[model samples]
Target chain A: MTDASNYSLLLDEIAAELDIPPSKYAQAVQRYTSVGEWLCGDDNSDCMDDPDVYPQGSFRLGTIVRPLKDGKESDYDIDLVFEIKKEKYATTSKEIKERVGTRLNNHGTYRRLLKPEGRRCWTLEYSETDDVGFHLDILPAIPKTPRTGAIHITHRSGNGTYEWSTSNPKGYAQWFEAKNITAFITLEKTQKNMLFESNRELFSSVDDVPNQLIKTPLQRTIQILKRHRDQRFANHPSHSSKPISMIITTLAAQLYSNETTTFEALKNIVFKLDAHANLQQHDFILEKSLADQKLILRTPDDKWIIPNPVAPEENFADRWHENNHERAKMFFQWVKWVREDLVDILAKRSVAQLTESIEPFFGERAVKMASSRLPFLTAPGIITLIPTNTPHIEITNPPKPWSK
Target chain B: MKEIVERHFQELVSEFKYLSLVHEEPEIFSIQGNIEFTSSYSEEIIHDSYNITIFIPSDYPNSPPCAQETGGRIHPSFHTHNEGTLCLASNIETVRIFDENRTLMHFVKALLIPYLHQHSYYEKYGKMPFGELSHGAKGIVEYYGEYFNTSNPIITLLLLKIIAEDNYRGHSICPCGSGKKIRICHGEKLLALKKLKPNSFFVYEYAECVFDGLESDSIPTELKSNYIYKKISNKNVWQHRSTTHSPTK
Candidate 1:
């Protein structure tokens, strides 16, 4: 086995630099909660006692990375799924979208921030701030039951046809949370105790603990991977169809062995993810006509699918079939890049070499800042050749070969 | 030679705080210690120290010292040879760079430190930072490529094959694709190289990496006589796994 200390140290430094600061996280929490409160209180819409205005996506999974800037703005996408009672299940998609849009438009604070209605969610773009700034994508959804298993929401297909589409954000988030509950709990206890010691008023009891406040190895690994993916594909806007967050989260969770260290977890998850895909191939039923040699992601039973853990009908790999498996190819390419970068970084000794290896994955600024935090580290100095008086070996010829 | 060896040992013990000369003689001297290596500029300790021994041969400055990790905590990527001899540099490189006037400090800082750094790094991480040079023949070809200032491994292989021969007539074409006579082209360099690598086995080993294998006639008489073909075993399930997901696009 390798020493593993340097690897762990480097990952820890990257995580410390990348993870959202507690103050900024709290600000984001306050902003999104305010949006939720405003939607419920507005008399213009039918947002009653508990109109499910909770986070979904990365924030909910506790794998949120500081988003890249868009032009002059550094915007965070805080996806808040707003689900009301299913009393009006037959309501038109347009009507459902407009209802939430109308409520947000009427609110004094939200009126200026409300963006033009999109196909599905109503975007509320917040202005930039010093540390953090984000927009709330309020997806107006109606759940089958109040507990959130399956749901119907507005979706805009090509040719601008708005219609009811199926989704299960709450179920998906709950399933993701369950993937590493034990590790989360252990991390939660340590983090909470630390917070309590610093300030007892921060959290009263364990019951009120917020998941986002604690960072688990699994969570940090996902965040780092996501950030790397974002940077990797920043230039290739066309391949924006790269593997989505849900697929990455699901695959990572499936392969994560709850390794205590972020370095081990990241390495294990990345290596095991491709292997898990290979396992998926073995389990999948083959087509008689089509050769089953290549790496294909599909359901073992019949049709190609990366089924949502919450709602099996919703295939997260929906685009894979149409895109000619470009997504699948790109996913593995990314995994290879991650592995190589990790290996190169850990194997490097000098700070310059370390920075050079990591800059490609985690942006230049992030690497520079993270590497600086390493203790007793000295920058590599330029070497000037000093003439030496060492004696050289006298050149001699070997015995003549058969005179060719 | 004895004065050169003694002087080098003295320089090493003086410069490196953790090192001290243990045994000494006119022909051979041995030194062992905890080598506390630090970065060039920062001078900050890199990591867990290494317990090592340096054995200087009678040839002194003409032949570099044989340094080894005596602690047995060596990483495979460190290129530690049998009996813990550190493969610090290629044989030709050692000969070309070795100088009689260079101090033990010069040798340790230039050769020994880098090797130990690589060992430390490989211990922490499973891979070498700058990829390794394979030992023996393969290594000779690699160094020869750099020594000749040619990036093409094929040409380097050819150069080795040609150099392994005893005579090159003045009118013979150069192996470098230059139509000029060998005497007018690379004759001087080839004559010099004869001192460094006298064997043509390096060319065969290098050829195997570049192509499938060389024909018997294509191999030099020295190499072809001793060449033994080893059968390759079938790939396991992991190799097949790569084929299943091999990037198509």
Candidate 2:
């Protein structure tokens, strides 16, 4: 759990420097929504909408990103929840442990600290002071469930505001087919003190996200801005990579804190470092549907997710749509030398030079040519889809259904 | 059934005519009688040291035993990251002794029995094996004067991990077994010892791991007449598992 007061102090300091009201914390909520919505409806096929994600026990399905109490000013962990749902769940813990142990025994390392306990819970860790090795854990949590076998999820507004919802996933799926408001739910009673259910959604964990929606991407344009922003900041001085701590600090200080994140800014960042980042990922999937095409966008159960554009009908395998005249050979080398110092700076700044300042470097060949070659981007098949029903209209391949 | 393994183990130890080594390293003497089998491990663990802890599940033979490790003290590989528990291939619990046609006598004599004196750090106050620098632990054979014999650390971190993981799926093997794998013999006591000093790698006395069944003739007092066979038994599954020889506190 994080000490909110401690973070409020840090946020207060930043606010003083920016001359923004402390209540501006409200804006973060909007940014989060934008990130989520953008991911759900991006051009990349990796963004997925999964009705199939369900918790077996006391586990919840989203990521918990918050400040840490370690006081190092930058230490934190991304905690996730998962538990077994069957009568044999207890036995599952031991089995899960053995599965991991078997792999370690085969891999072999130099030294270590930590061993499995008898009854429940197992962790694998390493420390230079006490021990030196990487650690992983399989913790057991006893979930609180209703005897009647129904599930409930709750939401909180800023300060005293609050909202709650009850759901029977089995029934929700049947109904989701008839409605399209975007179903949300939670399988865990609590996620960092903010209770999550199987239906209600909250991106920043802060309440009242719908009203404060500017920081969020109201449309698709923000996605492109964010990609470009990410690429421009990929390389900056002061970036370190030996121990993981430095990279983590850089991430929190330079990336997650940014409220001005845009889709294009992000695309430029991703395009340079890893052009194939979400190449194999899909947007969504249509399961057991009457539609002739079952292809639905696929989403992953990971921390970061986003939407990508389908290739324009005019452009196929040719990524050289706009820059056919420019030599692509030298461009690839420049991207290979990326670092995260720029990301650190971007994490705090509201605008990026990639879209405004750096766009001119590529000239006319950069902006307009990309669409001339490729029609639609194809997501990989790494995700699983169990869709009930989602809206879909056939793409006639004209300006590539994306424009229409 | 590690028991079939136990039988072949029994025959292997019987072949060393208790008195034969008398002609070799005279400091060690024996009047060959029944040799005990102790300690066995899965081949999956590919770490620094060969030492392992195999857990014997309740349903023996039919159900495969689980292999685990501890201390992360040593490893032939970096399998166990920290908590020093490595798990090996599982669900294979049939009596499997290396060579089928070999008699227990030939097995023990030909394969084990030599491990008893493999490197007895017991002679020293647990300091013979190592220093704090070379390897994290103490009390092991100084292989090459710098590292423990099996790289100076008798138990590698990887082997420890494999054994620790084994406990999850199988039973722990007490190092004090007569000569059997901890799984088939006195495994409960070993499990109890888990919490004592799990992460304290250097504190565990390697000498204690040596199963000293018969009294050392050098100690005198209780050999039928004075010519008691002082044989340091080779490592056989039964001998490693035997609870008959109590561990000296």
DockQ of all predictions against the true structure, Cα-based: 0.04, 0.00
Candidate 2 structure quality by residue, lDDT tens digits, B80-164? 2233333121001011221223343332322222221121222223331211212222212221112211342223322233233
Q: Tell me the docking grade of candidate 2.
A: incorrect
Looking at model 1 chain A, which ten-residue stretch has the lowest summed lDDT?
A395-404
TM-score of chain B of each: 0.66, 0.19
lDDT (Cα, tens digit) per residue for candidate 1, span A212-312:
76777888788878878877777776457667888788878766778888878887777665553443344544443222322234644433566676776
lDDT of 1 by residue, B1-249 (tens): 766666767666554544556655455677765555453312323443456778877666656777876544565445666655877776555544444235677666666666665556556666554446655555555666766767765676566556443445667887778788888887787777666543443433343433322322234433321122211112252234224422111
lDDT of each: 0.62, 0.25
TM-score of 1: 0.57
Instruction: Encode model 2's per-residue lDDT on A1-404: one tens digit a residue.
Output: 01122222222222122121123222322322332243234232321322022222101111111121221111112111122232323333344334323433433331133354423323333332322112233332222253423333222334533233233433322322222112121211222233222113444443433221222211111222222222333342311111122111112222221222223223244333334223233443223331222111222531221111121121111222123312122223333332222222222111211222333322233322332222121112211121123112221111100000
Clashes of each: 10, 172
